[model samples]
Target: MSERKPRKDAARNRAAVLAAADELFARRTSPEDEVTMADIAAAAGVGKGTLFRAFGDRTGLIHALYEARVEPIRNAVEEGPPPLGPATPPLQRLPALLDAILCFKLDNRHLALALEGTGSDSPYQAGHYDRWHALLQAVLEQIPGLTDSDFTAHVLLAATRADLVEHLVGQRRLPPEGLRAQLASFTTKVLGSPALPGSPAEQIHS
Candidate 1:
Protein backbone atom coordinates (compact mmCIF):
# COMPACT_ATOMS: atom_id res chain seq x y z
CA MET A 1 0.00 0.00 0.00
CA SER A 2 2.89 2.37 0.69
CA GLU A 3 4.27 2.11 -2.88
CA ARG A 4 0.79 2.33 -4.41
CA LYS A 5 0.02 5.40 -2.33
CA PRO A 6 3.10 7.26 -3.62
CA ARG A 7 2.24 6.48 -7.22
CA LYS A 8 -1.31 7.71 -6.79
CA ASP A 9 -0.06 10.85 -5.10
CA ALA A 10 2.35 11.51 -7.97
CA ALA A 11 -0.44 11.18 -10.52
CA ARG A 12 -2.65 13.52 -8.50
CA ASN A 13 0.11 16.08 -8.20
CA ARG A 14 0.78 16.05 -11.95
CA ALA A 15 -2.87 16.59 -12.73
CA ALA A 16 -3.20 19.40 -10.20
CA VAL A 17 -0.11 21.15 -11.56
CA LEU A 18 -1.32 21.02 -15.13
CA ALA A 19 -4.77 22.34 -14.17
CA ALA A 20 -3.32 25.14 -12.10
CA ALA A 21 -0.92 26.13 -14.86
CA ASP A 22 -3.74 26.18 -17.41
CA GLU A 23 -5.79 28.52 -15.25
CA LEU A 24 -2.81 30.80 -14.75
CA PHE A 25 -2.00 30.88 -18.45
CA ALA A 26 -5.64 31.60 -19.27
CA ARG A 27 -5.60 34.62 -16.99
CA ARG A 28 -2.26 36.16 -18.03
CA THR A 29 -2.04 38.07 -21.31
CA SER A 30 1.73 37.98 -21.50
CA PRO A 31 4.38 35.30 -21.07
CA GLU A 32 6.42 37.69 -18.93
CA ASP A 33 3.60 37.36 -16.42
CA GLU A 34 3.34 33.62 -17.00
CA VAL A 35 2.84 31.41 -13.97
CA THR A 36 6.02 30.58 -12.16
CA MET A 37 6.91 27.24 -10.59
CA ALA A 38 6.34 28.76 -7.19
CA ASP A 39 2.96 30.13 -8.26
CA ILE A 40 1.93 26.84 -9.80
CA ALA A 41 3.05 24.91 -6.74
CA ALA A 42 0.98 27.20 -4.53
CA ALA A 43 -2.06 26.98 -6.76
CA ALA A 44 -1.82 23.19 -7.07
CA GLY A 45 -1.57 22.84 -3.31
CA VAL A 46 1.86 21.24 -3.64
CA GLY A 47 5.41 22.32 -2.98
CA LYS A 48 7.75 24.08 -5.43
CA GLY A 49 10.02 21.07 -5.14
CA THR A 50 7.28 18.86 -6.46
CA LEU A 51 6.64 21.11 -9.45
CA PHE A 52 10.33 21.09 -10.31
CA ARG A 53 10.59 17.36 -9.82
CA ALA A 54 7.70 16.74 -12.16
CA PHE A 55 8.60 19.12 -14.99
CA GLY A 56 12.31 19.94 -14.57
CA ASP A 57 12.08 23.73 -15.09
CA ARG A 58 9.93 26.59 -16.39
CA THR A 59 10.55 25.83 -20.06
CA GLY A 60 9.90 22.12 -19.54
CA LEU A 61 6.61 22.88 -17.81
CA ILE A 62 5.57 25.17 -20.66
CA HIS A 63 6.53 22.46 -23.13
CA ALA A 64 4.34 19.96 -21.29
CA LEU A 65 1.41 22.34 -21.14
CA TYR A 66 1.74 23.18 -24.82
CA GLU A 67 1.93 19.52 -25.83
CA ALA A 68 -1.11 18.70 -23.72
CA ARG A 69 -3.13 21.40 -25.45
CA VAL A 70 -2.02 20.38 -28.95
CA GLU A 71 -2.70 16.65 -28.51
CA PRO A 72 -6.26 16.80 -29.78
CA ILE A 73 -5.27 18.61 -32.94
CA ARG A 74 -2.44 16.14 -33.47
CA ASN A 75 -4.80 13.21 -33.13
CA ALA A 76 -7.33 14.75 -35.46
CA VAL A 77 -4.76 15.28 -38.14
CA GLU A 78 -3.32 11.80 -37.80
CA GLU A 79 -6.54 9.77 -37.64
CA GLY A 80 -9.78 11.75 -37.70
CA PRO A 81 -12.10 12.29 -40.67
CA PRO A 82 -11.88 14.33 -43.86
CA PRO A 83 -9.80 17.50 -44.36
CA LEU A 84 -7.57 16.73 -41.37
CA GLY A 85 -7.14 12.99 -41.56
CA PRO A 86 -4.51 11.22 -43.67
CA ALA A 87 -7.10 9.89 -46.10
CA THR A 88 -8.04 13.33 -47.45
CA PRO A 89 -6.60 14.52 -50.74
CA PRO A 90 -3.34 16.47 -50.40
CA LEU A 91 -4.80 19.61 -51.99
CA GLN A 92 -7.85 19.70 -49.68
CA ARG A 93 -5.96 18.70 -46.53
CA LEU A 94 -3.34 21.42 -47.00
CA PRO A 95 -5.68 24.33 -46.40
CA ALA A 96 -7.57 22.46 -43.73
CA LEU A 97 -4.31 21.88 -41.83
CA LEU A 98 -3.45 25.57 -41.97
CA ASP A 99 -6.96 26.49 -40.87
CA ALA A 100 -6.64 24.10 -37.96
CA ILE A 101 -3.36 25.77 -36.96
CA LEU A 102 -4.87 29.27 -37.17
CA CYS A 103 -7.87 28.21 -35.13
CA PHE A 104 -5.66 26.55 -32.54
CA LYS A 105 -3.69 29.75 -32.14
CA LEU A 106 -6.91 31.74 -31.81
CA ASP A 107 -8.36 29.38 -29.25
CA ASN A 108 -5.19 29.12 -27.16
CA ARG A 109 -3.66 32.50 -27.72
CA HIS A 110 -1.83 32.92 -24.43
CA LEU A 111 -0.49 29.40 -24.26
CA ALA A 112 0.53 29.44 -27.91
CA LEU A 113 2.49 32.60 -27.44
CA ALA A 114 4.05 31.29 -24.26
CA LEU A 115 5.12 28.06 -25.90
CA GLU A 116 6.43 29.59 -29.12
CA GLY A 117 7.14 33.09 -27.81
CA THR A 118 6.36 36.54 -29.29
CA GLY A 119 9.98 37.23 -30.20
CA SER A 120 11.46 37.52 -33.69
CA ASP A 121 13.56 34.40 -33.10
CA SER A 122 13.14 31.57 -35.58
CA PRO A 123 10.90 28.75 -34.28
CA TYR A 124 12.02 26.34 -37.00
CA GLN A 125 14.11 24.44 -34.47
CA ALA A 126 11.10 23.49 -32.36
CA GLY A 127 9.77 19.94 -32.56
CA HIS A 128 6.25 21.03 -33.52
CA TYR A 129 7.66 23.14 -36.33
CA ASP A 130 9.59 20.22 -37.73
CA ARG A 131 6.54 17.94 -37.58
CA TRP A 132 4.33 20.49 -39.31
CA HIS A 133 6.95 21.31 -41.95
CA ALA A 134 7.55 17.67 -42.81
CA LEU A 135 3.84 16.86 -43.01
CA LEU A 136 3.14 19.90 -45.17
CA GLN A 137 6.07 19.21 -47.45
CA ALA A 138 4.89 15.65 -48.02
CA VAL A 139 1.45 16.90 -48.97
CA LEU A 140 2.76 19.59 -51.30
CA GLU A 141 5.00 17.09 -53.06
CA GLN A 142 1.95 15.12 -54.13
CA ILE A 143 0.51 18.10 -55.99
CA PRO A 144 1.67 18.12 -59.60
CA GLY A 145 3.81 21.04 -60.84
CA LEU A 146 4.35 22.21 -57.27
CA THR A 147 8.13 22.19 -57.29
CA ASP A 148 10.28 23.01 -54.25
CA SER A 149 7.69 21.59 -51.90
CA ASP A 150 9.99 21.94 -48.88
CA PHE A 151 10.42 25.70 -49.22
CA THR A 152 6.74 26.08 -50.02
CA ALA A 153 5.76 24.28 -46.81
CA HIS A 154 7.97 26.51 -44.63
CA VAL A 155 6.57 29.73 -46.13
CA LEU A 156 3.03 28.43 -45.86
CA LEU A 157 3.51 27.59 -42.19
CA ALA A 158 5.01 31.03 -41.62
CA ALA A 159 1.69 32.55 -42.59
CA THR A 160 0.26 30.99 -39.41
CA ARG A 161 3.12 31.75 -37.03
CA ALA A 162 2.07 32.47 -33.45
CA ASP A 163 3.36 36.04 -33.42
CA LEU A 164 1.83 36.75 -36.82
CA VAL A 165 -1.57 35.53 -35.70
CA GLU A 166 -1.32 37.52 -32.46
CA HIS A 167 -0.41 40.65 -34.40
CA LEU A 168 -3.24 40.22 -36.88
CA VAL A 169 -5.83 39.41 -34.24
CA GLY A 170 -4.70 41.41 -31.22
CA GLN A 171 -2.96 44.48 -32.64
CA ARG A 172 -4.18 44.83 -36.21
CA ARG A 173 -7.73 43.95 -35.13
CA LEU A 174 -8.39 41.61 -38.01
CA PRO A 175 -11.28 39.28 -37.25
CA PRO A 176 -10.25 35.66 -36.72
CA GLU A 177 -12.52 34.38 -39.46
CA GLY A 178 -11.33 37.05 -41.87
CA LEU A 179 -7.70 36.16 -41.22
CA ARG A 180 -8.58 32.54 -41.88
CA ALA A 181 -10.26 33.38 -45.18
CA GLN A 182 -7.31 35.46 -46.29
CA LEU A 183 -4.95 32.61 -45.47
CA ALA A 184 -7.05 30.09 -47.33
CA SER A 185 -7.24 32.43 -50.30
CA PHE A 186 -3.54 33.16 -50.22
CA THR A 187 -2.88 29.44 -50.00
CA THR A 188 -5.25 28.69 -52.85
CA LYS A 189 -3.49 31.18 -55.06
CA VAL A 190 -0.11 29.70 -54.23
CA LEU A 191 -1.22 26.10 -54.73
CA GLY A 192 -2.56 26.75 -58.22
CA SER A 193 -6.08 25.82 -57.16
CA PRO A 194 -7.78 27.89 -59.83
CA ALA A 195 -4.22 28.67 -60.88
CA LEU A 196 -0.80 29.11 -59.23
CA PRO A 197 0.56 32.57 -58.63
CA GLY A 198 3.17 33.58 -61.21
CA SER A 199 5.95 33.79 -58.62
CA PRO A 200 8.37 30.87 -58.58
CA ALA A 201 8.39 28.43 -55.63
CA GLU A 202 12.05 29.05 -54.64
CA GLN A 203 11.36 32.73 -54.05
CA ILE A 204 8.32 31.99 -51.90
CA HIS A 205 9.99 31.49 -48.53
CA SER A 206 12.82 33.94 -49.25
Candidate 2:
Protein backbone atom coordinates (compact mmCIF):
# COMPACT_ATOMS: atom_id res chain seq x y z
CA MET A 1 0.00 0.00 0.00
CA SER A 2 1.17 3.56 -0.70
CA GLU A 3 2.18 5.42 2.44
CA ARG A 4 -0.90 6.85 4.05
CA LYS A 5 -1.02 10.62 4.33
CA PRO A 6 -1.02 12.13 7.80
CA ARG A 7 -4.64 12.22 8.95
CA LYS A 8 -6.68 15.38 9.61
CA ASP A 9 -6.07 14.67 13.29
CA ALA A 10 -2.48 15.84 12.83
CA ALA A 11 -3.67 19.19 11.54
CA ARG A 12 -6.01 19.52 14.53
CA ASN A 13 -3.18 18.66 16.86
CA ARG A 14 -0.98 21.45 15.45
CA ALA A 15 -3.75 24.04 15.86
CA ALA A 16 -4.46 22.94 19.38
CA VAL A 17 -0.77 23.24 20.24
CA LEU A 18 -0.58 26.79 19.01
CA ALA A 19 -3.83 27.79 20.72
CA ALA A 20 -2.73 26.34 24.03
CA ALA A 21 0.59 28.13 23.83
CA ASP A 22 -1.06 31.44 23.05
CA GLU A 23 -3.50 31.11 25.94
CA LEU A 24 -0.78 30.23 28.38
CA PHE A 25 1.41 33.06 27.25
CA ALA A 26 -1.37 35.60 27.46
CA ARG A 27 -2.32 34.52 30.97
CA ARG A 28 1.18 34.24 32.29
CA THR A 29 1.79 36.87 34.99
CA SER A 30 5.53 36.70 34.75
CA PRO A 31 8.08 35.53 32.21
CA GLU A 32 9.60 33.19 34.77
CA ASP A 33 6.30 31.36 35.33
CA GLU A 34 5.39 31.12 31.67
CA VAL A 35 4.38 27.81 30.07
CA THR A 36 6.89 25.38 28.65
CA MET A 37 6.92 23.22 25.49
CA ALA A 38 5.96 20.17 27.48
CA ASP A 39 3.04 22.04 29.05
CA ILE A 40 1.75 23.13 25.67
CA ALA A 41 2.21 19.69 24.11
CA ALA A 42 0.35 18.05 26.96
CA ALA A 43 -2.44 20.59 26.80
CA ALA A 44 -2.81 19.92 23.10
CA GLY A 45 -2.65 16.13 23.48
CA VAL A 46 0.53 15.95 21.41
CA GLY A 47 4.10 14.90 21.93
CA LYS A 48 6.90 17.41 22.60
CA GLY A 49 8.47 16.40 19.31
CA THR A 50 5.26 17.21 17.48
CA LEU A 51 5.17 20.68 19.03
CA PHE A 52 8.83 21.22 18.19
CA ARG A 53 8.27 20.15 14.60
CA ALA A 54 5.42 22.62 14.32
CA PHE A 55 7.05 25.67 15.94
CA GLY A 56 10.76 24.92 16.49
CA ASP A 57 10.85 26.20 20.10
CA ARG A 58 9.17 28.42 22.68
CA THR A 59 10.49 31.64 21.14
CA GLY A 60 9.18 30.52 17.76
CA LEU A 61 5.82 29.73 19.32
CA ILE A 62 5.65 33.18 20.94
CA HIS A 63 6.52 34.84 17.64
CA ALA A 64 3.80 32.87 15.86
CA LEU A 65 1.22 33.82 18.47
CA TYR A 66 2.20 37.46 18.26
CA GLU A 67 1.86 37.52 14.47
CA ALA A 68 -1.41 35.58 14.47
CA ARG A 69 -3.10 38.01 16.83
CA VAL A 70 -1.60 41.27 15.53
CA GLU A 71 -1.86 40.73 11.75
CA PRO A 72 -5.65 41.08 11.83
CA ILE A 73 -5.50 44.47 13.62
CA ARG A 74 -2.83 45.69 11.17
CA ASN A 75 -4.99 44.59 8.23
CA ALA A 76 -8.03 46.35 9.68
CA VAL A 77 -6.09 49.59 10.06
CA GLU A 78 -4.87 49.28 6.49
CA GLU A 79 -8.07 48.15 4.73
CA GLY A 80 -11.11 47.93 6.97
CA PRO A 81 -13.86 50.44 7.79
CA PRO A 82 -13.39 54.23 7.59
CA PRO A 83 -11.85 53.58 4.22
CA LEU A 84 -8.83 55.68 3.32
CA GLY A 85 -9.59 58.10 0.46
CA PRO A 86 -8.03 61.31 -0.74
CA ALA A 87 -11.44 62.98 -0.65
CA THR A 88 -11.91 62.27 3.06
CA PRO A 89 -10.95 65.22 5.23
CA PRO A 90 -8.20 64.53 7.76
CA LEU A 91 -10.34 65.98 10.56
CA GLN A 92 -13.06 63.46 9.66
CA ARG A 93 -10.74 60.54 9.04
CA LEU A 94 -8.71 61.17 12.17
CA PRO A 95 -11.61 60.76 14.62
CA ALA A 96 -12.93 57.72 12.77
CA LEU A 97 -9.52 56.07 12.81
CA LEU A 98 -9.08 56.92 16.48
CA ASP A 99 -12.40 55.30 17.31
CA ALA A 100 -11.56 52.25 15.23
CA ILE A 101 -8.16 51.88 16.86
CA LEU A 102 -9.57 52.27 20.38
CA CYS A 103 -12.24 49.69 19.58
CA PHE A 104 -9.55 47.28 18.43
CA LYS A 105 -7.62 47.79 21.65
CA LEU A 106 -10.74 47.28 23.77
CA ASP A 107 -11.48 44.02 21.96
CA ASN A 108 -7.93 42.68 21.92
CA ARG A 109 -6.69 43.64 25.36
CA HIS A 110 -5.12 40.29 26.19
CA LEU A 111 -3.33 39.95 22.90
CA ALA A 112 -2.03 43.49 23.22
CA LEU A 113 -0.77 42.79 26.70
CA ALA A 114 1.05 39.73 25.45
CA LEU A 115 2.73 41.66 22.65
CA GLU A 116 3.69 44.54 24.93
CA GLY A 117 5.04 42.13 27.53
CA THR A 118 7.92 41.39 25.20
CA GLY A 119 9.49 44.71 26.34
CA SER A 120 10.95 47.57 24.31
CA ASP A 121 14.16 45.66 23.63
CA SER A 122 12.44 42.86 21.72
CA PRO A 123 12.46 42.97 17.91
CA TYR A 124 8.69 42.47 17.87
CA GLN A 125 8.23 45.50 20.14
CA ALA A 126 10.28 47.72 17.87
CA GLY A 127 8.47 46.51 14.75
CA HIS A 128 5.05 47.16 16.30
CA TYR A 129 6.02 50.67 17.44
CA ASP A 130 7.43 51.50 14.01
CA ARG A 131 4.27 50.29 12.27
CA TRP A 132 2.07 52.38 14.57
CA HIS A 133 4.28 55.43 14.12
CA ALA A 134 4.02 55.10 10.33
CA LEU A 135 0.23 54.79 10.50
CA LEU A 136 0.03 57.93 12.62
CA GLN A 137 2.33 59.83 10.27
CA ALA A 138 0.18 58.88 7.26
CA VAL A 139 -2.92 60.14 9.00
CA LEU A 140 -1.25 63.38 10.08
CA GLU A 141 0.16 64.20 6.64
CA GLN A 142 -3.35 65.14 5.55
CA ILE A 143 -3.88 67.72 8.29
CA PRO A 144 -3.27 71.46 7.68
CA GLY A 145 -1.11 74.02 9.51
CA LEU A 146 0.78 71.90 11.97
CA THR A 147 4.16 73.30 13.07
CA ASP A 148 5.39 69.95 14.43
CA SER A 149 3.08 67.46 12.79
CA ASP A 150 5.33 64.45 13.23
CA PHE A 151 5.78 64.98 16.96
CA THR A 152 2.07 65.51 17.42
CA ALA A 153 1.35 62.30 15.51
CA HIS A 154 3.67 60.31 17.75
CA VAL A 155 1.91 61.68 20.85
CA LEU A 156 -1.47 60.78 19.41
CA LEU A 157 -0.34 57.24 18.66
CA ALA A 158 1.05 56.75 22.13
CA ALA A 159 -2.15 57.99 23.75
CA THR A 160 -4.23 55.43 21.85
CA ARG A 161 -2.06 52.42 22.56
CA ALA A 162 -3.66 49.38 24.17
CA ASP A 163 -1.65 49.51 27.36
CA LEU A 164 -2.70 53.08 28.08
CA VAL A 165 -6.32 52.35 27.27
CA GLU A 166 -6.32 49.29 29.48
CA HIS A 167 -4.90 51.28 32.32
CA LEU A 168 -7.68 53.79 31.91
CA VAL A 169 -10.54 51.34 31.38
CA GLY A 170 -9.54 48.25 33.31
CA GLN A 171 -7.67 49.70 36.26
CA ARG A 172 -9.46 53.02 36.59
CA ARG A 173 -12.83 51.42 35.79
CA LEU A 174 -13.67 54.22 33.38
CA PRO A 175 -16.38 53.39 30.90
CA PRO A 176 -14.86 52.58 27.53
CA GLU A 177 -17.41 54.76 25.80
CA GLY A 178 -16.63 57.73 27.99
CA LEU A 179 -12.92 57.14 27.67
CA ARG A 180 -13.08 57.11 23.90
CA ALA A 181 -15.02 60.34 23.85
CA GLN A 182 -12.62 61.99 26.25
CA LEU A 183 -9.71 60.80 24.16
CA ALA A 184 -11.25 62.06 20.93
CA SER A 185 -11.86 65.46 22.50
CA PHE A 186 -8.41 65.64 23.99
CA THR A 187 -6.84 64.55 20.72
CA THR A 188 -8.62 67.25 18.72
CA LYS A 189 -7.64 69.86 21.26
CA VAL A 190 -3.99 68.82 21.14
CA LEU A 191 -4.01 68.96 17.35
CA GLY A 192 -5.46 72.49 17.60
CA SER A 193 -8.69 71.40 15.92
CA PRO A 194 -12.19 72.05 17.23
CA ALA A 195 -13.83 69.04 18.89
CA LEU A 196 -16.19 67.06 16.72
CA PRO A 197 -19.73 68.20 17.65
CA GLY A 198 -21.95 65.86 19.72
CA SER A 199 -20.65 63.50 22.33
CA PRO A 200 -18.84 60.44 20.99
CA ALA A 201 -20.32 58.86 24.12
CA GLU A 202 -23.73 58.58 22.46
CA GLN A 203 -22.24 56.99 19.36
CA ILE A 204 -20.07 54.72 21.52
CA HIS A 205 -22.92 53.54 23.70
CA SER A 206 -25.27 53.10 20.81
TM-score of each: 0.88, 0.71
- When summed lDDT is taken over every stretch of 10 residues in candidate 1, the lowest stretch is 197-206
Give a tens-digit lDDT track for model 2, residues 1-206.
Answer: 23334656667777798788767756654335657788888887889998788778765676677677667656655665433333446776666666756776676565555555555544236456666667667778777776666787777777777668778877788998788878788877877887766544443334
Cα lDDT of all candidates, in order? 0.80, 0.67
26-140 per-residue lDDT for model 1 (tens digits):
8876546656788888999999899889999877887888889889889988898766788877877888888788788888777777777522355666667889899899989
TM-score of 1: 0.88
- Looking at model 2, residue 166 earns an lDDT score of 70
> What is candidate 1's local distance difference test score?
0.80
Which residue runs does candidate 2 get wrong by more than 4 Å?
A: 1-14, 21-39, 48-53, 56-63, 70-72, 81-87, 120-124, 197-206
Pick by lDDT: which candidate is best?
1
